[model samples]
Target: MGLAERRKVMGYSQERFAAVVGVDRTTVGRWDRGETTPEAIHRPKMAEALQLGLAELDALLTPPPADFPECTASPPCDRHGSEGIDDMIRREFLRIMVVAGSLTTLAPDDADAIAEAVDRGSAEDFRLMNGHLWQVYQLARSKSSVNTVVKDQLGALNEALKESSRAGGLYEVAGDLFQLSGELSFDGNRYTDAAASYALAAEASSHARAYDLWACALVRHAYVDVYERRYTEAAETLDVARRVAKRGNSALSTRYWVASVQAEVYAGLQDLGACEKALGEAQRVADLATPVHPGGWLRFDGSRLAEERGARYVQLGRLDLAEETLRRALETKTLSRGQSFRRRGAVLVDLAAVGAKRHDAEQVVTYGGEALRLAKKTGSGYIARRLQALQGDLRTCRRNRRVVELNAEINAL
Candidate 1:
């Protein structure tokens, strides 16, 4: 049996098996595909996990001979001298999306990549994979869980950047990848790391002249400031993002997403009129026609705007409005559930905050308890952070047993 088949027989899924070896699951995938080998450190554990002797494991790692090369020659060509990526390149790039991270080290391939231009086809390959990684990142419970694979993919793209004869497409890929790195950092509350990654993403997208991507990167950078309660600083950043998005595709929701975030910062600064005005601009997204928001890199389809609006109201101390709006948002089917629980959990936390404002112990326990469960279920640091912020509010009802238990749980996270 081959390595993949042997792994299945041992009842270890790729994720489980990778965890055993202390590596990203994609590394196990590359090993199964014969595109790479297990490092010395991983082999012994691989053998043990796969129920193989060291000798047998070594044999298993040698994949059966194939009719084609494991990886294609770069600056690709067919026998007829037609230029483009082959089926192998397409497949390889699918796996490559999760492989990259920060562009800290220059790979050895830089010299070779700079020798010939990477075509639009190759750039598209990276784009497709980059989009997939965003989907994976959104669905992942612990956002940090994606950190390793993203770093590895960035390394791969670092070489791709060198190989590019046409720089535009590759630069866009760089923007996309760096934003993902920023997202992982942001999700983990590593604001310093997030700032650095977002700055790189902004630079790359600006180089590609991709207004939406560039604007989004700036918006994300501003979020770090918002989290730190540096409302004025965040507003300055958003002002720039707003102008950039104006130059973006009119068909996109980029401007509206920027407006949505701007509303948050305005609420933070206690500027009710400005906050409401920004929110009205955000509401305009529901009117756009055709060329819908791309689910991967730009998922702001206005689906979560209601929840966002409600949360902003909470920030503005509009308790009555916040409670009503948040409850309505929860009733709607738009809030993602199942493994997609981040937004929903935030809504619950908001409702709990409203209850805490009223010193309503039952309401606090009801909403806070559900939010806590979602945080634990998803291993989501974002939800945990929101719940942590609510800890002070929960103290008003501390005499209640459920509130006390909830406080302890949030503290544990």
Candidate 2:
């Protein structure tokens, strides 16, 4: 029997079952509809409420395939023992990775060898390869091209984790891979999946005693809240990230990244004084001569500070400041070279937003058009989303033919 049938057999209504499980009625409804599974925390309560053992609960919850038999004999045979079950689970994980297009290139032997190397405490090669994958992911014009390799790396890390003898180094590598997974999800606008990946990254980093990696994951997770307009939640998450960053290496500039993101959260909250203070803290990273990012995962080196500051100013409705900062960002060598279309597109969109605020239709058309083109060329959901925001601003100047055309073009993207 499924969850709904089990609940009915127990003589408990959906509302009462939800109360017993300490969740909303809609959550119970979602489970019944197969929309989402119970989170880890809620599963025990659900089992208790149904008066069922964990195994029995799992069996009921899982729908059997058409070819699978329902045992008619008493005391079902335990054909797949613990070892078999574990092997099956791993196989299923690999199958899902294949279906998701995350493990296309690497052979099973290659994955096994990498995992074995990590388990034997020789993780340098694995780490270096993962770092190269991250660099490729960042520099590639089509971000999705790197997903298969990253996913393959994650699969190898998971295999290594099954052996606990050398877990410390494996955890560290796993943390980095999780962060890369989060970045891939975020770039595709899968915010919920990104948040889950970041949460796992933080947990793995904590187990490895890698404070900077943990804090970086927290910062990335906070972005989900920030983008969703959960300002208070984002601020609270960033505050924890800041405290964690304090315990990380002073040479790494992790704290500076925390400060930079804090500025964005502050701008979202409209706290101008706090925003400026955080921005000032982020600026200190520019003074550090040595490279701050070792793995290419935490790539915030203050090169994009001008554009970031402009974005914060735009968030705060300071058009005069935003226009100047973004224009300066456009002139910066990094942006001027056009190597990073995502960065340039963001700056252009912000500048167009400023122009829309100032009712300068010509400026809006010029910047917005270029941003739209970059969005198409790069297939960047980040840039497309920013243009959607610009679309709202252009509506105010809809009377202008240029503004109307630009708005339509953005909508097409």
Candidate 3:
């Protein structure tokens, strides 16, 4: 059965389910009528609220004409797994050194060390190291771990990109590196850096003729602009990404991911109509059930519906809805083990944000503290900025000493 049917079967009334899921009853109704669909991040929550397993929920969410050319054959996994362990480890160490330097305002030599490490690492190793660095950058920025280190990592990423010209055998590897670079910059609240990396990734994707990668890269780049309140720029980026995704097999998971992100951008702009349009498009692209596509890294099917949808609502100032949707999203299986800590921290921040909006100081203090604790574990700029934003919300709790302390702690970060 479809989402609405599933909810109904679970004995959830439209209003009740909307409350439980943190969305308007109308939005819930839209899902039932097939007029709208949840974003990928929200799928886990929807599955939980409806009491379905991931596999079954995914099947229900799949769009029709359920086959695509890409699904006709499996993409080869020819890239060697751990083909460059030594390089990866060395580069990782250097990246750590660079981040340490950046935070402590240490001498430029440490930053240089990170660059040298990247220069020596293999493409796969660099990519792997880049992933870890991205997380480190986020955590460090949130906790003010070390500016020098963060800068050093950024420098290392840049050096790696420069060394690896966007070409054959190295193009995908380089693209992955560039994407991670953008993610790091974005998480670090360095919008300009994020934009530059994403642009480079898009170029590499074009060279490799990988539409999904190109689209996802650009979409992420747009996210920084969206956060900066540059809605026009964000929308423009997504417009290009959407077109690029269409050029490939839209049924591919990345295409839907693009749609989901675009939906959030639309919501951020307060363009509810456009938001729904993108959401519908995402749902349509996600209809395919074929599992023949490649499935490591960058494999985002419409699997986290509640989180994505709820996040958009949160952006739209629909706090009541945001709470329900975000809470429901929390029910989804935690994101990948390595990544769950950061993602869950973000959701907690969102949940705390809703509480802050409601002037619920106790809830804010409770959730915000947990979020801060979790944020300390990762080096994500996104989480840092989120905590930063909530500082203003805590002003209402001036009378609440604990709330005042929480705000101070977050500010300290």
Q: Pick the candidate with the highest TM-score.
A: 1
- What is the lDDT ranking, best to worst? 1, 2, 3
* Candidates 2 and 3 compared by TM-score, better number: 2
RMSD to the true structure for each prediction, in A, is 13.4, 17.4, 22.9
Residue 20, candidate 1: Cα error in Å is 30
lDDT by residue for model 1 over 344-392, one digit each (tens)?
8999999999999889989998999999999888888789889998998
Q: Positional deviation of 150 in candidate 1, in angstroms?
A: 1.9
Q: What does the lDDT read for residue 300 in candidate 1?
A: 82
Cα shift from native, residue 280, model 3 (Å):
3.1
For each candidate, give its TM-score against the true structure.
0.73, 0.71, 0.59
How many clashes show up in model 2?
Answer: 0
Per-residue lDDT tens digits for candidate 2, residues 1-413, read: 78998899998898999889876586688678864556445779888988988888878777775453566766774455433432343343344333322332322433323345435554564588678888798888878776655654555455444433435466667678778877877878778778877887787677666899999999999999987789899999999999999999889889999999999999988999999999999999988878877856688888888899999999999988898889999998888899899999999999989988888998999999899989998999889888886777887688999889888887787
Model 2 misplaced stretches (Cα beyond 4 Å):
1-122, 163-166
Candidate 2 matches the true fold with a TM-score of 0.71
